[model samples]
Target: MAESRSCDEVLKAAFPSIVQKDEVQKEFSHFLVSKDLLPAITRYLHTQPGLHGRLTLLWAVDNRPTRNTYGLHYLFTLEPSHRWMLLSAELAGNDRLFPSITPHIHAAQWYEREIRDMFGLIPQGHPDLRRLVRHEHWPKGTHPLKKDFLWDHVLGRQQGEHHFRRIEGEGVFEVPVGPIHAGIIEPGHFRFSVAGEPIMQLELHHFWTHRGVEKLFEQQTLTAAVPLAERVSGDTTIGHSLAYCQAVESLLHLEVPRRGRYLRSLFLELERLHNHLGDVGAICNDTAYALPHAHCSRMKEQIMQLNDRLTGSRFLRGVTRVGGVAIDLTAAQLAEIVAEMDRIEQDFSELESIIAHNASLIDRLETTGVLTERTAWDHAVVGVVGRASGLDQDLRRDRPFAAYDELPVKVVNYRYGDVRARMRVRMDEIHESMRLVREVRLKIPQGPVAGEPSRVAQTGEWALSAVEGWRGEILYMVTAGENGTIQRCKVRDPSFVNWPAIQWAVIGNIIPDFPLINKSFNLSYAGNDL
Candidate 1:
């Protein structure tokens, strides 16, 4: 949007008062602010022209950090022109409270709440510092995401759901929805305070699928842990794999070959097209447009068939490995994928025409569950959700990696940020991904699939990687071995950052529109549960 932040020496000048500023490794830099200096440091970074850089990516990281007194870390991203910035910060483990950045950056709310849930780090003056991803009965002193925490035992210990605070005012009634919902979805509870038919306020309780993925990664070796990353979401398999692979490459000091990069981009675009088709189609189904849903699902079926033929896995698992690709696409396989894409293109064109011209479908989506630009930015939502709001921040174009360097992406921007805006973005992305798929066929490079991964990472090595996923940027952090194994690894899904935006979007709309708005965001409850 703006050219990368100017090189500013003033970041060094402003940050030291908070804590000792230090480089994370030679690869990344961070300013470690003491608890007392955080508010001042946050003010400086947001206002500082020279140092704050383009807030490239923002999510909190939790580890049973043996090195920190509080055993926790908070990260901020600063990049000049989407190229790079250091990504390390500290939250004192002892203070238990840090000033909230929600008032300052607006994008930091869910990130702060999630960190608090995972590591028990309290943020002072958080406008809405409610529990986000943890159960209500989840013990106070025993956060399951910590280094030596229990999962099954904690659930066993908790009785029925924690009783919520009651309101005494007349004509205020509470409606309780399920933690175990009706749909083929995970468990999350929603309590609404409704005066009559209109909802006054809603309180959501999440954390039914708590697998402790982040804490588990810290304990597992990187090579042994790639499977876990792939399962972050069955649909976002390729994106998470790429981020993890890139982080491993940084830890071991290896770069992927040009051909490997090209192939990775090829699979990524294929994955993107397939998911967007299914999602847009599902949205229509929710609005009771069955024909559009059927057409969309059928087209998606063809896409998945193409994926099965080309990659040997419908989801393309094991296609990415450390330092490069795990599998190479043969010439014939690529050709078949290209032909399938052409057929799907025709199918999509007809489908879009039918849905756009249908007045009933149009009325249902035109203005429901609108999220304003201020709410979108303050929450820092991304993917189709952010694109619909007119924040055209796609990492593939802004910070090019893989074959994306060759094929520039024109990000779709819509300012309305409604059901219509999101649907438009998804529809357009399918068109863009189609073009990329063909371009990939025309320029498939030749090379070995992978380099031999090192047995262990040396000490004092860290790498950060961010991939533009179907939903938005997914980030990964890897710290090299302390004793022949990975010291730390952290994964941040865009769903964690964007889930809270749904709350803002549904505020004024009738409860019936909540399903469509939620579908537009399509946040993964399981992905953020970690």
Candidate 2:
């Protein structure tokens, strides 16, 4: 497995583009490199002929002692079997200026800005270096993730300084989208410079409901943080849970039971199957394809209902605790699940095939939101978006954690990087998830599901845990040896990396089609807001 390669080997293979490489600590490989080399390094790994840089996750950490953001860490997981390495590059704090990986690795844009916004570390030459998940009136230098940023002082943060930016051109009319929109979804503002519907420039502002999730998690205990993590994004409970649990497991060195491991994978795929169905249906609904949209939404509801019946929560919350799975499956339920999956898979396949062949449906999605392979990698897309764009970097198959390590799993990849390609990947993955579910159900072992977590975590140690979430790789890095609670925690959603790639897709497209393209990516606003 490429997961087995040492930090030394990874460094040696991709040495020229890399400036400084070494192990930061066990399980976390760290690299210090020139800022100018980042875009080149992004291309070296993420968009190379083969998968050299399969972006795992990119997040910035606030070093408590220094009271400043220490490093902008980008984890690029490598393709195993091939003689390649995933670049884990970090641009240091003092020399905060870094080149835009957006030009080379499309997914890195938002990550760079998120780091830019939260840490105040600017990506010097970035192309659309706009503020994300930060308010327009929130004061210039008040980065929330910093140690000194006090929420209690919110009422007195010096709000008004005439913060105005220009969208000037000869005939360039300004279009202001919402901090509050017509839809009931969360609020975000989009300012576009347009000449007749063709987008001349676009600016996205994303801090409508900030919620302060990272800071909130810092205040709560491990068990208490579970609910916050579960609520980080409404639908990604399992994904966030798995990432957090893996972090705890590494901390305590707990070996989850075979049964618990299988159950974990089962619940995760269940998460994937349902979300992808809902998202795919949503994309069609945006395209005005009612029949398929209705059918797919109904089918998706069935998937969620299955989770409610089995896990006792519609979104599968609390089923996964720190050490292992909180709920165990019975043999009879497993058999029934296998039987039900067999039928559900067939129904979905038929409905999807009908939708795929419809002429109007094809016309709507054939070339819309075209994110090329080069852009997809540069932006460090994950899950459906990355897979569809031919990035082919799935954490499950590559890293093989939990029950997935024992099973035969394939990462479905599509090359065109358009709306149809994104939809097709989600469709194929639904089938693959179904097959895995059946196999896991049959192989369900008899054992205890939960492990008792240790009362105290050892001090001053660092650990990283990664799980292949339905969306993409979910990363959780921790450090807490000095105190009773977490000293520093960095949470990264795939959208942190993927959201900026949409900027490229929106360029030159009709304004109305932007929604279609955006839905195809279907990035989590809630996840990004945190």
Candidate 3:
């Protein structure tokens, strides 16, 4: 295991080209390896015992203007140690090619394709190099994320249909659903190949709502990027904003006030509370049980009202800033929040009991949309989806960000890996979040909510922030440009990772059950599309 080996020992064994090891943040270790060794090192880290072989993120940075090279970063976390190891490689000149890790690591599939679509960096051995982020109408050879590409440039649309893979067999038929759904949900195309009632294969197509968020980040000032980050995903405002703020704070070496940390945690838990409450109810709604679903909506609405009372926004936007929070909670507001927590908990308990005693709802959820533990790991699923599938990894407890470091988190996990299991995880999490909010309110310190923003250092530095959002782990990687401006910001929403698992989960289930299975996961289309 990488945990037992010292940094020097691991470096000596791996023989990386350039190593930057820091002791202050034991969770991080950076290495610059040659492009040729990239795949081998990645495979080694993933296959080795005690390392847990989890690939957290794979992203590319366009450094052609400054460094005359495109840099690739592979972020991995070793279990038990909770340490992050980054393997980086540079593709110089016109030979922008690197071996694809997807063949060995299934989770790297979409990432590799995304690099091909956005940066024009070819993953040489990638099995399927079709466009991932860019739509079929997008002009060929137009890589939007490249340094030479204009942020606001518009391209003429080309008319063509995306070719989805077809399954050939007796009694096999295809059903295509929504790039535009009947509901007000975001756009995503799902092609399901079915044999009678059972799904044979499912192919998903997203990026319909791709808004050039990363390109927009390149245009914003360091301080001005927080609000933009908050808007990355409407449901995950706190998660994305907090992750961005933490990354900037890490780069500037700024310490948030103790009270501010608690407040941030409080906001995070509140965000989790409403989201989980709504998801639990939505799962019940999928079973045609409207009572629990309506009750869940009511509870969620109450939480949002509380959020509006505490922060200025219903979704808790604009509350997070670089170095600390934008606002502090008054004593009266804190007391009200505590009282709200009690009511929410009590109400949630009653609603949970009602859903649990419903045999029909249980039948609809249990043994349906089962995402096995193996499938979950292969896709690198996270959050409630990953927890329900028996993956014992949670960033809050494993990485310990914000007030989570001071307050213990009770991670809820289930081995069933079904819709019921996923709902149960959310049910347990709601209580856990309520308990955390109470703890934060009782122990919150008295101090200023925010610290002065530190002057941007001219040095080019990179930092990573991971937040355990309600859906899953939200990761942000930021690199400082000249004069402390952001050179590049890579956002990895949990939905981006968990969406792939849905295809596998729906394999044995009937077509009608697809909606129920999909709701069980409840991924964010906007977040994934971004």
Candidate 4:
């Protein structure tokens, strides 16, 4: 094989036409590449050993009615350097066709499909150009992201059909689940191609809760959008809100106070603790092992109660603001949190002991729903799922944010890629989160929790913010419009990336075990739809 080369070296040798764009933001290095050459460059950046880049996100901005064009931005995280590279390409007013990178980069598949649905930009060589975000009822030719499309515009429903892929063979049959499900879960449809008891293939249809969140962000002031971000996923309020705030802070060159930084990290870990605890119980419950499940639920409730006392919200909403945190921690509150962590840790230890001794639960989880490392990487899976599959990437350790740079963090990983492995990851992470909370109590400084913006947000300037949420990584990309108004806000929850992995993970598992496998990942339907 030929030697791997740096991005600059490759650009200089192969594509000199792609020039460096002026630096408009501090978060990433910007470059402007030809629309046709985008696929080739993306392949090199993603595959080349020297760069070791992972395609972080792909999004489009409508410059229509202003420049009569649509611009595409592909963000790549250089894994080796932990830095960001953004390649931008433009489609003229009349041209909506762009070469598809999905044929070479599998991770770009859903993003490309979403672009096609929302912006009417066609990916010429895409294998599947099926509507992703727009449901069957959405009118044809309705591109909601365009500048002329008002956020409040209502359109008449049009009849359409979504075609799902099918595998045909002698004994192959299809089993369809729901866009609506039992319990209080959100909507998602799962189709399984089965041969007797084993699944031949599994595919999921999501986006039932699509709320036009990105479009709603348009024209909203930075301060006013925090609550909006908080609601992106009810369970991930801190993750999404912090990601949004960090991007806005990046734009205004604002530095949160030391105390606020520690506080943010504490709250984020608390959020992780509650979610992981609940999932552990839910996964156990799926196996008919209700003892551990009940205890785990109790532990989760205690954490939520702690959150209510500390932040005045069980989900930790309304605490994160544009510059920093809206709430401050008193000495008594700090002591209370530390004491609570001690008690929860003890209770979790006993619960884990019970789970470990339960042979029936282990039998169900072990060797079930295995997602290989290659498959996880291909889907760009994040958080607990990716770690369980042996993808050793964590933003907290790889790209530290808040107080993570100061506090010690252990990235728990497992190579088995089974339901058991996923459960173990969450179990380990719960302990780690408790440790982080205690560390924050010790090292946090006394200071203001908020900071004032020192710089102005320039029009067309964009920044990216990433947080390692309980489930995995949450990314927010914010672009400024006139007078510091949001032009576009791109939110990427971990569920959006990991949802595709579940389909691959369930291939050989039995139909009855699907619930256990699904609960292992515990993805957010609301987050993915948004």
Candidate 5:
């Protein structure tokens, strides 16, 4: 790999008209570009070589009190440099309009729509400028995320309808699947345009479970927000909590204890282990294969029990605090965890063998619900979905955090871009996570599991953190207000980025295969709805 370049050097070389007043920190470099230059700059960063061209996050902040203007922050990661560049643009006066980059950067489609829905900031020139997060019942001209909007305020209901796109042709019909699912999953509606058995297009509408998580964070003190972060997505409790904690710790320039870092890594891997095991089974179950699903479920239950024994929660909630983890592992507990890893490895290996040899199962998975590499890149999918499509990027290795700097990671990737490729990536990752847990348990240093919490000084500062969750990269962007109160907290779950890719993934597949393809991606509606 080539030596990394500074953010300023890269920006100057790409766009010479860039101005001053930008902020550059160790974690990321912030730039302030004009509305007109936004699209050009975004396109350059995305298509340029070695820049990685991935939009980690894009969010709007109500900065009227401090700057008397609304601000938009666009965060991008350059993989080769392992650096993040944040482009900031302020919308002055009543116009609150900014040129949309969605035309050039396809991944900005939903982010732009979300800004329009939440902050009422218009993304001018956007192809589809429809309401995203706010559904039909939400009152018009009322933006929930604005600083002036009362958190507890409610408005009278209105009669409205969602206008889903239609396909006009002979023998063409639309199938609407649910904001209410058959299973116990969260609410999300999938509109499929199909002819007979084959699907022509798929459009997804979620946000039914949007709980105003970001708005709730604004009312929470610095320390009181960890629990909220843990609940961003129930299954990704550890990942979201760790990301939020790291961002807070970064702002304060606090370092966690070495032992705490190792413990955090162990908990993260344990979370990954359970989720991957359950997903493997779920995917098999979708294919009508019961034996592998049963075995995988058995192994997954054992890990969940171990989690409850180690931490207070089965999902590893309340384990991560701002400074460090809340609990430490005893020598006996470490030994037991390591022993459990051995048993899990043996059992999972047998399950993998059975899956590999089953001809019927193999036939169902191979080339089913294929998401081409082009589609993955256009949508900027991450985590297992990105890796399975040959986008070789993992935040743990690309940008190390917790104990990952000391304990290196080997990324698992495949180019098939099919259901089988995604399943293989998950299987390989389970083994990798188990190995990491064993290594951390054996080589972990004996020391305090947490450090003293730092006093956050009142300042206008922002911090960013990214963790490679089982699904993909979970990003947290935190900004501090007076007395260290959270002014704005933006979370970009992997589901948000990967959900759009599903529209393309299910294009050519049949209606019955939609469930299997959806399981292969295994996105979270609650996470995205936030």
Candidate 6:
């Protein structure tokens, strides 16, 4: 129980010598710091008394052709003031070595490595400098994200190897699973070092299908990129697309119509319902509990079919446009949605009763795959994963995008951070989402479903947009280029940050429980790899 301080108060006391730029936008406040002061500022923001900031994202934008420098942007969330502070630093085109903050900020590890692999800007003192997005076959010097690199540039493969961390001990053996999984799951390699039934260490190698997604956005118009955002993760169509559209809208100073905002909240919850239902069922299936799994699957299918009837797409794609929602819900359609939700909720409650009565399933989940709150905080975990681990911050409730401000989302949190905690969080959230959906349908105002853009985006105008997708917070940072083209569109899927938490979750758990643990914290590979 600690009191909070204002951002200005903390900055004046902690960084009196440091100067911040005056440019502040609706999304966040911008500041330019030197490379040498990067680590100091990050550490202060992360560990300070009231300013315990979480490194939301760390990404680099190639500023070539416009300037002979690369821009490294660090986005931190200060919960006390509910403000996002963006620290930007420039690395000269010729000088690529920038000081790494990963040494002090654990959450910044993968982000810095990604910048190195994509932009060729090395974090001078990072412990693990190995390829993050780029694999060994990718030629050493071919950094695809540099502004000079063409989107279609093809490179020849070269012989190389990736070294995974090895644990050497008596009776400690390695279990390597999947760059190719047996199921229809996406490609990701998991290396587990187990000491006779208990996991000691787990190393993950993902991004097998890095599509150079960010690079593809460079020359595309803002409107044209909506479909691309929808496909960032097939499951999170509304989440990704809404975030991207909002970023564009922010830059253009456009406001979505009231009805459009309400419909958005409805669609987002529908997306959450289907995904969470599938995940709950998948978790049960992994534990040999087939009845609830089957029931959950049926419920999920019902919601998806409902989505198609309402939005014309099963995954709810093409429904979110730049200014607002593309589709509208009529009075009859709204009533239909309510009736459908009632049936599903009743069925889900019955299933939940069965699940709660089952002793064996509870035993299997209780202490399995525990990701401590401290670890969750260190990694900047989000959404269901973070909520399960007692990091009680939800963008829907905290930041309030779409219709969330009016709807008043109830954030679900659990401190155990176990498989059961994660499962319970999802279960509670399912009920909350259902309530929100019903409320949105009830009080939706009569207005346009979409809004027109106020004006064209000026070059260099940028904004950050976040939507609390089913999995977690989906962040889209879009910077306008010449003639309203996208200079850079950075997409940070929840999976990108949550994937690393799985390594900690698996420790002390046996190999047999890995599937259950993973399913409980279901993450998107396409979203992360993108």
Candidate 2 lDDT by residue in tens digits, 171-272: 878788887776566777777778888887676666566788887776766544667777877778999988877876776667788888899999998899
- C-alpha lDDT values of all predictions: 0.74, 0.74, 0.88, 0.89, 0.89, 0.90
Lowest lDDT 10-residue stretch of candidate 5: 1-10
Query: What is candidate 2's local distance difference test score?
Result: 0.74
Tell me, what's the RMSD of every candidate? 3.2, 3.9, 1.7, 2.2, 1.4, 1.7
lDDT of each residue in 98-146, candidate 1, tens digit only: 6776677777766677778776777788887667667666656666555
Runs in model 3 deviating more than 4 A are 1-11, 14-26
Local error of candidate 5 at residue 300 (angstroms): 0.8
Give the winner by lDDT.
Answer: 6
Candidate 2 error regions (>4 Å): 1-28, 31-51, 54-58, 64-72, 79-109, 120-130, 157-171, 481-484
What's the TM-score of every candidate structure? 0.90, 0.86, 0.97, 0.97, 0.98, 0.98
| Model 1 root-mean-square deviation | 3.2
Backbone clashes, each candidate = 4, 13, 0, 1, 1, 0
lDDT of 4 by residue, 1-530 (tens): 12223555565566678877654654456789989999989988888877767788999999886788899999888777767788999998799999999998888899999999988999999998888999888998888888878899998898888788989989999999998777679999999999999998998888999999998899588768999999999999999999999999988889999899999999999999999999999999998889888898998999899899887899999999988899999989989998998998998898889889988879889999999998988887888999999988889998789988899698899999999999999999999998998889889999999998877898888788999999899999998888879999999999998998899999888999998899999999999999
Q: Provide the global lDDT of candidate 1 against the true structure.
A: 0.74
Question: Which residue segments of model 4 deviate by more than 4 Å?
Answer: 1-7
In model 6, which runs have C-alpha deviations exceeding 4 angstroms? 1-5
lDDT tens readout by residue for model 3, 1-530: 34545743665476646556444355577677888887887887887765665899999988778778889989887765777888788898777788999998999999999999999889989999888998889988899889889999988899877889999988999999998997778899999999998998999999898999998998886777999999889999999999999998988878889899999999999999999999988888877899998999999999999889777799999999998998888899999998989988988888878888989889889999999999998888888999999999888899888888899999999999999999999999999998999899888889888888666745458788999998999999888887767888999999999998899999989999999999999999999999
For model 6, name the residue pairs that clash: none
Model with the higher lDDT, candidate 2 or 4: 4
State which candidate, 1 or 2, has the greater TM-score.
Answer: 1
Tell how far residue 128 is off in model 2, in angstroms: 6.4
Residue 459, model 5: Cα distance from true site in angstroms: 3.0
Q: How many residue-pair clashes does candidate 2 contain?
A: 13
For model 5, residues 154-271, the per-residue Cα lDDT tens digits are 8767788888889989999999999888877789999999999899989988898899999999998777799999999999999999999999988887889999999999999999
